[model samples]
Target chain A: MHLSEPYLSRRALLSSVTGGTLLLTLGACISGGQEPSPTGPDPIEPVLAASVYLADRYTAAMAAVPDLADRLTPLRDAHQAHITALTRELGTVDDGILPSGRPPAVAPAGSESTPAATASSGNAAAPEVTASPVPLPAERPAILADLQGLERSGRQQAAALCLAGSRYRAALLGSIAAARASHAEVLT
Target chain B: MTTGDEQLAEALRAEHAAIFGYGAIGAKLDKATAQFALQAEEEHRERRDALLLRLSQRGGTPPAADPVYTLPVAVTDQASALQLAVTIEERVAARWRSVLPQAAGEDRTMALDALIGSAVLATQARRHAGISPATVPFPGAPA
Candidate 1:
């Protein structure tokens, strides 16, 4: 549904009213010695896992849709870039390392089984681990939706990572957020 | 209710809802749209799993998904679907905001960035839907 005109106007009015105050509050919050939280092991590992997962999915998508291969190639490249960047950052951090609790069971590519079957096999290896589903759609709209979702998810994970990391990590996450924001705009 | 675990549960709940919402979103669009839906669904799945892992690591049982969730509005068309997406992102952003107080350091920055990113995505969705005031005044303001 469309935003009601009144609602839009009210939002604008409210923003105008509180804009300065919010900025000042944020500034104070930043200036105050409220040092950012340390990166905890529980949070960082999943984000890294997600980055790797997306990169793999993108590779699969590119292979499945040769027609959109040229278009999607850059997107896949971008995800790989993110994976590298996040891995490096995580390497430097002290907390939030995913426990060697269990290795993620990844199936061999192009095996006799269907992608879904392979994914299921992998899942069986690590019963507690849940991953994004395999067997994606090859259509452009479907692909775009998946990409947007991936970017949005990445933004969330990056935000979490930023919170758990240091100033450098936060800045890195902010940049990632900017990229995801752009992805949302272009993917649509 | 505002404990770290509780707040994380809420965030995971929102992720579950968003994942479910993508099903409807995927149905309304063509192949191009399906791609976006597929990716979004995967992302939600990953986030949900991560949240579950986090809860388990803390010795808490992960929350289960609700049998159904109430959408803010019907999503019969592209515009409406995007609106729902904007709403989902905003809600998740709110959860991040709540978690910020309880979190420090990297977690705090991450939450702030997530909030900002959600706000940006919501604004983009609005603009794509041809809505006026394309930019939301506040990205993660309540409701």
Candidate 2:
């Protein structure tokens, strides 16, 4: 039950970590996660943001197409895992759920009917993939095409980021990108 | 060889094994799946050839393919064949995933292509084998 002196806030911890990493990466500015300096954006932010955006897309899709639940929910859960990994790397806290503002239109009926997406998850204890029972009846083809497009763009973005990232980061980004590419193939 | 070159060699080895594995898989499959296996084999051949050239251009004697490989599962019937197919794709995907961190430019691009390709193929094979949630969160990452 021991802790840092003066109960230093989480921001202080994050700042020191970012500052140390920035020294090697930037070699100039000695800023950290707290102080907004001229380092543009945290490189992790873009991929992290992309994962959040992709999760939202999944939420919308699941809400709009209930029958595709069995299909789409697992992909969405993968994004959740991606978000967890990225956030963990950034030294940020995440409960490992969908990131959003407004509440979901339809809440999950239950996790009982859902399946785990562990075939890809590195975390053995990763959460179960869940879905809602929304009554919307969209055309399956159109919905699928839209999802395929989302996955293609997401994959490309992550792939580009992977190329520019550090060795460790590259592996993480590459895996996430590969998942999206597979998603596109599945949708096709 | 540098790390990237080593990774390339490892991935190439996987490609070679996959080409051989698919042959075993195809023999037990029906016409539809046999055609599918042939296409996958062809793709692996192209990759293996490309990697062989890359290693040679780096001024080293590229390693020759193994005379044979011991498959993890027996391929005596359709069910086992499909299982072997999934197993091959999974192993190939794992090899490609290892290459991403070391690879650059053309190597990186090809690694990504192979990783994604194996992942997609794995899903299809899983579906054919009747595995649910055929898709994965991170295709090439360790389970």
Candidate 3:
């Protein structure tokens, strides 16, 4: 959808306004920060996955139009920086819940995947995982269109994520969304 | 006013400033750059009007625009004028971004759209100014 359109219709807004008022009143009655919530899946995981996907797309674009490497490399680098920032923000998700969620290949009790081994072998690095590059488009127009679509999708996802519970997460997501929108504009 | 309303009001104010700021910048630039500035100014004006209606419909009175604003940088030549345009767009983008989390549904959507619009405009301004790597890595975030 074009960015200018309102997310909800006027009728929906009216109804939501009433419901939101009640919710706000109810929310005020409860003391803030009194609940100790359990950590769920890292919300950044999906965003990180999206960043990787975007980076892979950039790589594919580079391969498809090597001459455009000068342009594509910076875009890819931005996604890489996003991955690093998001990972750092997440602060090592329970190894049990890797971003991929594929359950670290059934390692033995003393293996690297095991907490005991990880603790004993201080400074031991995790195995590096790589994403497969995307396939090439048949022509330059197709490639630009593909990248443009990917940028648009990334922008939408990041905008939705901008309302995340954590302020820092929301800020990061907003920045990514803005960056993606600029990318789309550049492509155009 | 609620936090969201206050933030939205602030965004409206920024839009008012941007709409005014473009008038100064547009005069100093070449035909092409002036065209971009005119288009961007119109967009900001449209956004401002929309935000005013939204605020009023919510029973919140929108802030009045100041007659003038002090530019972060002076606009003398075409180069400086372009820089001023970039600054205005970036400031407007930041204002819209601050409203996002506090807003919901349509308000949130409007904030996101405005933020993105300002960001793209800022990048365009930078490109027109012949800046290298025209787009910032993070448009609205504090550096």
Interface RMSD of each: 8.2, 1.3, 2.0
The stretch of ten residues in a row with the least summed lDDT in candidate 2 chain B is B124-133
Which scores better on DockQ, 1 or 2?
2
| TM-score of every model versus the real structure | 0.44, 0.75, 0.72
lDDT per residue for candidate 2 within A1-188, as digits (tens), equals 01111111212222233222322332122112322223344455545545654565576677777787888888887887886687666543432222221122122422221112211132222221122212222777877776676577667667766765566666787888788888887787
In TM-score terms, candidate 3 sits at 0.72
Between candidates 2 and 3, name the one with more favorable DockQ. Answer: 2
Question: TM-score (0 to 1) of chain B, per candidate?
Answer: 0.81, 0.96, 0.97
Per residue, candidate 1 scores C-alpha lDDT tens digits across A53-117 of 55556667777776766555555555545545554554532321222111122323223232222
Judge candidate 1 at residue B72 and give its lDDT.
Answer: 85
Error of 2 at B127 (Å): 1.9
Residues B21-116 of candidate 2 have per-residue lDDT tens digits of 987998898898777788888888989999999999998777687999999998889989999999999899999999988887789888888887
Worst 10 residues of 1 chain A by lDDT: A1-10
B37-75 per-residue lDDT for model 3 (tens digits): 889999998998998898899898899899888888898
Q: Taking the tens digit of each residue's C-alpha lDDT, what string does model 3 give over A1-188?
A: 12101111211221222222322232232212221235434444445545645665676678767898877777776776675566556554343223232222233322354322232233222111111123457898878877777677667666656643455455567788888888887787
Chain A TM-score values, per prediction: 0.54, 0.56, 0.58
lDDT order of candidates, top first: 2, 3, 1
Once all C-alphas are superposed, what RMSD does model 1 give against the true structure?
20.7
